[model samples]
Target: MSRIEVVAPNLKVRLSGVTSTIIQLVPVQARSLGIATLGPGLPEGLPKMRWWQVPSLLARPATRRMRIWHARRNVEMVAGLLLRWLFRAPMRLVFTSAAQRDHQAFTKWLIRRMDAVIATSARSGSYLDVPHDVVMHGVDLDLFHPPRGREDGFGAAGLSGRFAVGCFGRIRKSKGTDLFVDAMIELLPRFPDWTAVIAGRATPEHLEFAQSLKARIAKAGLSDRIVFLGEVPDIRPWFRRMSLYVAPSRNEGFGLTPLEAMASMTPVVASDAGAYAEMVVPGETGAVVASGDGPGLTAAIERYLADPGLAEAHGRQALAHVRRHFPLSREAEGVAKVYDRLWSAR
Candidate 1:
């Protein structure tokens, strides 16, 4: 078999947020940095190294280059330690922490072993033991941008002549899906021109919860106005069609849906979960309310519905805010700098 070898690079393990970050960052980072993944759940068309190939990878010519084992989980950090200490590989470990709460004993131990650490947001960094750099996640500007044609876009998606306020994410209690639905129920009657679209998948465990919300929407006699799109293959068009996006998550590591919506020039009414407060500018881009406050969410959404012009004005600012502050390229650049520091230290 032909051996696949590269200079100092990144190795991602496990299938979770870390894997998703790798997927989004690899393609862009690869253009200027050497990065690859070694795990399942990652799509094809991106570079990946095999588990069995790790030993061989350690044998390549040094050239003063050191592999960067960029771990986002405890297991991956352990794997990096084994490769460096046991196999004697020339590599340094780096970890990115997005957890908002306190870490367990074992998790802290693993984190202590890393050569460097990265936090997804400033709030996340507050929970870490060691000093770290804050590199907030960003959305793809090309994939998510201002609407080209709002009316035509809505019509293409089978919606018409309506103002859409959307809540997109997994359907579960933690995500505050019910909070959004309840708020919609209270406000939709006041504004006939506005509609609510809930787009996301409900896992088997949450099927009953999701169905209950659907039933409530039906019971309120606004099922037509309040739509539940289980899961969408492409959410970009949905965001483009929306005048306002609502993220009512009770908690989050660092939510990206709001960034995606803002990138699409859709104003947001989000709960102050994750880094949402940092992402949204109150009275400028959108409103941020306390999590689980149904009345607060209802009032915020009603404000946009009461004056469509406000939503439009906020959306324009949202697009500019995202464009100026958060872009996928900027995130990739931040990660690359971390890689450069690790590489140079070796």
Candidate 2:
């Protein structure tokens, strides 16, 4: 076939938000355009180009005047710059910024050289000095849909709990894992039927932090009520098992776990961090509390725990909200428009 017209470089060996985005979006994007990824750590099934194929990019594609190089991280941005400026690749450099924090001098310099820029959320866009388009991340509806029945999820998890409340993602201070644990300790005793589940792993550097939370749970004598499932292979089923989900991150670029949970028919209690405030409709789909405010998080979570019917109603609304506004197809289409505009300009 057809020559590749788009190159999405991951450039990271470890699993991260950027890597996950590439994995989820590439297949949907590939259906519309000639797109392939370049990097390590990605699954073998995804369409990928080897380092040996880098030389081929120096020439224009047969069907297109120039290819698009999409970068989500600093290293990927630097790689795109090297390919276009140093190696004279016939490509247009594009960088997607998910950071809400002010950019460093070096990062600003790197961003200025990009041919096009995309921000994952409006808040993330506000931090950028350069002109950019806002394209929010979306969840895969097929992968994270509602379970057939509540017991279906409970059976899949093999947990002994009438109702489950979960918090997922890396267990770290920044992720606010301790806040979730604290909330569970205080509330689980009141709601004897509810169980708290924490999924995700703590890296070597954060092992002590994770252990401390577990110790806290043991001290509270709620270790059996509050469980930890480290770095699950698939989190969708776990999401379905939850009566409510908590995203207690102190800070985030553009968090997708809330949307994922919402898509899985789980109501969320998220913090103001990331685009959570934008995604969660206060008093509707879910509640949005201030970041790092443990008391506020506890109060918000208690709203759902106190009333299971409210949680189920919100979960239904959340799934509808995500389907209408945050489907993977919408994100793929939005990015495609950016690509189309760049190609049209050429």
Best prediction by TM-score: 2
Model 1 C-alpha lDDT per residue in residues 1-346, reported as the tens digit of each score: 0222222233443334566667777778767755567766778888777667667656643443567778877778888888889988877788888887899999999998888899999989999999788999988898888877744255566753468889998899999999999998998888888878899899899999999999999999988888888888887888988889999999888888899999999999999988898899999999999988889988998899999999999999999999999999999888878777776773
lDDT of 2 at 96: 95
lDDT of 2 by residue, 200-305 (tens): 9999999999999999999999988899999888777899999999999998989999999999899999999988998999888999999999999999999999
Distance from true position, residue 242, model 1, in Å? 0.6
Model 1, runs deviating above 4 Å: 1-16, 60-64, 150-152
- The pairs that clash in candidate 1 are none
Residue 180 in candidate 1 has what lDDT?
A: 92
What's the TM-score of every candidate structure? Answer: 0.93, 0.98
**What would the TM-score be for candidate 1 when compared with the true structure?**
0.93
Backbone collisions counted per model: 0, 0
- Give each model's whole-structure lDDT: 0.82, 0.92
| Total backbone collisions, model 2 | 0
